[model samples]
Target: MIDNTSLAVVAPEILLLVMACVIALVDLGVKSRLRNLTYGLTLASLAAVAFLTGSEAATGETAYGFGRMVVSDSMGNWLKCFSTIAMMVCLVYGRPYAGDRDMLRGGELFTLAMLSLLGIFVMIGGHNFLVIYLGLELLTLCSYALVALRRDHTQATEAAMKYFVLGAMASGFLLYGLSMIYGATGSLDIATVFKVIAGGQVKHTVLVFGLVFIVAGLAFKLGAAPFHMWIPDVYQGAPTAVTIMLGTAPELAAFAIAIRLLVEGMLPLAIDWQQMLVVLAVSSLFVGNLAAIAQTNLKRMLAYSTIGQMGFVMLGLLSGVVNGDPVFARNAYSSAMFYIVTYVLTTLASFGVILLLAREGFESEEIADLAGLNQRSPLYAGVMAVTLFSLAGIPPLVGFYAKLAVLQALVVSGSPFYIGLAVFAVVMSLVAAFYYIRVVKVMYFDAPITATTVAAPAEVRVVLTINGALILLLGILPGGLMTLCAQAIVRMLSS
Candidate 1:
């Protein structure tokens, strides 16, 4: 009953596992100061895996592998490819910063990052609830270790503890909700769960209650308001390198799972879940923008920005099913996918600049610390300014197009509630823009706090430049990536 075809679908994941283990062993003989060896190996592994994913997607075959426990489709493959690229960029941006903070001493950061990426792969490909949960736990466990990597720092330790406790509770909520669904539907496979729900014999009350918990769990994962108490503390307290790792790539993984659980596995329950998302979205937009304006810590401010961004993503999701009309589902979900991808790209560049500014015995974490960034380095200041503009949804930037796509998705639904939601989101963007622009003002208008010359590794410079350029380039020519996202969603939905 072994299927070689199933193995083919997961070839990249298998290769990643082998590479991670090899790196772990190879790192043992490597010296601490020469951590570049570990970094090179990690990047090589990601490159190889990304190549494999691209090849898989090119085959244009949707593979139901491992007894349907996992799936390989264009959507999953593309996400995997981008996730690998994101992690590679993260490591590139994080390297010198990690070196300054003594974080690369033992290769733990590299190893943990690789493992977390492996977990993301699993989450993206999983087709069974148990498989998805296992992947979620894997990613969270690695994240906990990474957050606490700077064990000597009291703040890091405290952040790690808080993350652990809250993350555990969220896991419990998701598990209990999944168990209830299982008890009702008598299936562990996501496809089967959908079929069971579609059959219309399940208890309505039980399923709805289960959905309540599932949404709560997802809100926690997405860092949406009311369940987002942990993001600010964790983002502020963790090492900037860890914060960059936590912010960018994992979001793509999170988006994948959200698609898997809500759209794919629970489509029959759209009315219920869409209503829940509306509530989460409105609250997140209201709270995230309002809170971000008050933050002096740059990381914490970005954390709140993250919450508001997630709200936009939720708006797209909620608009997918208006009054039981799923005619616009693909458009809505694809728009959300596009939004998350662009947000992650902008986030990486924003944090890359922060990492570049940080030096030994100094953490450039406060917004005021960005004073005269334009004077120190106009290139990076321009990069940071573009990044902020993108986040604020300014025109001629990818973020603006992303927001436009999602708003269009909402308007296409032709529902008053969704239209109102779009208006509210626009207002929130305006509120959020004030803080983002304030950072740019400090960078250009205020005086330099120190005379430190801003310099990054050559690799980091190249990557950051490409990252910033892509945001603007995509804004100008949004067709290619937008088409790719739409095609992936359509293909996945059809298969």
Candidate 2:
């Protein structure tokens, strides 16, 4: 029998699942005129689930059960809440475009989004290897179907195939790692492996092998360097709304997984993976920023930027310069969590504008398409400006403050290597800024391309307004959010 702990821990996911089923059934009994009804219910359900997560945070409840296969802690609470909000924003961003295109209102897209979010909760709460794999596969399969939802489009079909095949390969790497670790310590829970390693119960060779594959798999999810080849193609080809979900929500889920596996599972052997993380961080920073400069496609550019942002999170992890320790493991987990929140808001605002530009034959993925945007619509120009600046880590923007906090944490740890890495980060910031500034220049300086006009519904405009203001507000006055991050991470580590 399942325990009360597991039941309470998984309440939010269960609520979402019930809502998904109800929406599908509601589609049948309801009139075609009530298609908007499904959309409304879907968003409302997610908002309700987020409220539950908030309650969990407020009460500081952490539950573990099913042999520790599922966990509901500070980490999962934050991840589920953030991902649900991101999903809602994706809907807000996409509804107008999807309606304008006469896309199917089968209620499938929103349903699938909630299902995928269910998978994310599983991934965040997973404490066992098989549970993690199952969650990932569930989430990935939904994503593949969602990407191909616009099936009449050849580009959408091609992107789905690419995502499926590559995603399978990444899963293979994760399974291989799980197998190796099981061989080494005869355990599956992440916490168990940490115990086994600390107890010296595993052979050195097997442990090292397991560690390598695990990092490789996690890096792919995080979209860190050497494993990021799929991101740009997927982003460019998928629908703008789906792209927003992929670019924002999945990164936060990956961030949560890494915290559980590394901080809870592998800290006993921190020295072994610390340098490995550094290499990944540096590679992602340099490659992501530099490649983005040449991309004309806005989705692709943001995809690269996502890679760099993950690298910054990796820097916090590798430095061991967290809330507590340097030479020993610490709780930099909060820094990673906080950074993901800022990135989510920044990307939603960024992509919300991209969605607003989508017309009958054009989606605003290309940077050149934004030329003369200020003349076309000053509201769009202003929103894009704030979004772009925040992403480039410009000051007073939440993005800049997020980056500053991470770098400051690392620098204060007082390690020469981390200090030098912080310098490299500064240089890459310049590289990233060059691309961000280009969007501003095109919007302000150039004329709209070819007398083109973009039509967005009022709903999309409202989403754009909220997204824009939040980015600026978080950027300028980040004290409250930063405090939350600190508090959350402390709860996770000290629990």
Highest TM-score against the true fold, candidate: 1
After superposing candidate 1 on the true structure, give the runs of residues whose Cα lies further than 4 Å from its correct spot: 32-34
Give the range of the ten consecutive residues with the poorest summed lDDT in model 2: 321-330
Model 2 lDDT per residue over 1-495, tens place: 988877888899789889989988887654553268888888899999999987787766677888788888875787788888889989878877776654545777878888989888888889888888888888989999989888787887888899899888988997898899888888888888888888986788888888888899999988999999889888888888788888888877888888777777777767777778998999999999999988988899989988888889898778663333444234355666778889988888888888888876777678898999988888989999999999889978888988887787678777777789999988999899999999899999987786666567677788889888988898888888877777777777766
Report the lDDT tens digits of candidate 1 across residue range 196-226: 9989999989998998888888889888888
Scored by CA lDDT, what does every candidate get?
A: 0.91, 0.83
- TM-score against truth, every candidate: 0.99, 0.96
Candidate 1 whole-model C-alpha lDDT, 0 to 1:
0.91
Off by over 4 Å in 2: 29-34, 321-331, 450-455
Candidate 2, residue 387: lDDT: 90
